[model samples]
Structure formats: structure tokens, C-alpha cells
Target: MKNVTIYTGPLCNFCDAAKRLLARNNVEYKEINIATVDGAMDEMITKANGKRTIPQIFFDDNHIGGYDDVRALEKENKLLELLK
Candidate 1:
């Protein structure tokens, strides 16, 4: 199984949407709330290669961008392959 990590902030609609999408696909993920954790934003930026955005997702260390990227993967029928 792929190890999925989501860097998020509280009250972020995109984050919530991303979580829901993952849940619907039965993909388990770790959620890191950057808003409440010090240094979390920096970590996310580093992982994302300087994309300062909420809902930075990593699948087994593979950067997956944000919610839109996730949805695009799903739309293209590539999400399940990555999840595996």
C-alpha cells in the first residue's frame, strides 16, 4: 500500500475535499495540520518543492500536488495505480 501524507490547514475546503476523495477510494492517509503545528508549513514547502499551498499530498514520497491534481488523477483513471 502506498503511504499517503496530506499537509493541510484547519477549515480548508480543499483539504476536506481531498480527504473525502481518498476515503471514497479506500485510501488511508496521514493528515498533518500545518496551522496547528510549528514547522509543518516549512516541511510541506520542502516536500512540495516550494509550492506554498494547502493540501499538499505525497504518495509514498511522490508529490501529488493539491486537490485539483488529485481529482485530475482520478479523472484520468490513474489514482488507483498511484494508491497501489
Candidate 2:
């Protein structure tokens, strides 16, 4: 399986949804809640190409973006492929 990392924030519905999607797929992920960690947002922005949104998901080196993006991958039947 690939390394799954997600930058999230508290109270973000999309973040919850993104995490649920991964969990539903049995994908192990590292969740970085920016709201609880200082400078995490900055790190997320730098890593995500300045995207300030919550649930910035990454699989290995591939940036999978937000909730919709991850769902798109699932819809296209590519999400599990990435997990492998």
C-alpha cells in the first residue's frame, strides 16, 4: 500500500468526508489536523501548492486534492489502485 497523508482542519465537513472515504476503503492514512498543530497550515499550503482548503489528501507523491477529488478517483475506480 502507498503512503496516505491528509491535511485537515477541525469542523471541516469535507475533511470528515474525505477521511470516511479512505476509511471505507480500508486505507491507512496519517491525519494532520492543522487546527491543532501550529504551522501545519503553512506546511499544508506549501505541500498543496498554496491550497488553503481542508482535506488535502496525498497518496505517496501524488496530490489527490479535496473531498470531491478523492470521490472522483473512487468513481473512476482509481482510488484503490493508488492504495496499492
Candidate 3:
């Protein structure tokens, strides 16, 4: 399976929703709390191709963008392929 990592901030509804979707799909992921980590937001942005948003998702070191992007992938039935 691909290594999924999510960069999120505290109390973010989108982040929580994204995590819930992943959980429902039984997707394993690493959650990084950018709120408490210095420089983590910057790193997330850099890795996400300048997307300065919370809940930046990565699939096996590949930036997959934010919650909407993830949901779109799921809608298109592409998320599971990436998970593998």
C-alpha cells in the first residue's frame, strides 16, 4: 500500500472529514499536526506545490492535494488504486 500522510491543523472540519473518509475506507495514514509543529506548514506547502492549505494529503510521497481533491479521487474510484 502507498504511504499516506496528512498535514492538518487542530479543529479543522475539512481535516476531520478527510480522516473519517479514509478511516471508513480502511486506509492507513500518518497524520501530522502542523499546528504544533514549527516549519511543518512550510514543508507541507512546498511538498504540495505551493498549496497553502490544511489537510494536505500525500500518497507515497506524491502530493495529492487537500480534502476536496481526496473526495474527488474517491468519487472517481481512483483513491483505492492510489492506496495500493
Question: Which candidate's TM-score is highest?
Answer: 1
Which runs of model 3 end up more than 4 angstroms from their true locations?
A: none
TM-score: model 1 vs. ground truth: 0.96
Using lDDT as the yardstick, the better of models 1 and 3 is: 1
Q: How does candidate 2 fare on TM-score?
A: 0.95
Candidate 1's residue-wise lDDT over 24-81, tens digit each?
9999999999988899999999989999999999998999999999999999999999
User: Candidate 1: where is the Cα deviation over 4 Å?
Assistant: none
Q: What would the per-residue lDDT of candidate 3 be over residues 18-50, giving only the tens digit for each residue?
A: 999899889999999998989998999889889
lDDT, candidate 1, equals 0.95
lDDT per model vs. reference:
0.95, 0.91, 0.93
Q: What is the lDDT of residue 25 in candidate 1?
A: 92
For lDDT, candidate 1 versus 2, the one ahead is 1
Please give each candidate's TM-score. 0.96, 0.95, 0.94
Residue 4 accuracy (lDDT) in model 2: 95
Instruction: Give per-candidate clash totals.
Output: 0, 0, 0
Off by more than 4 A, model 2: none
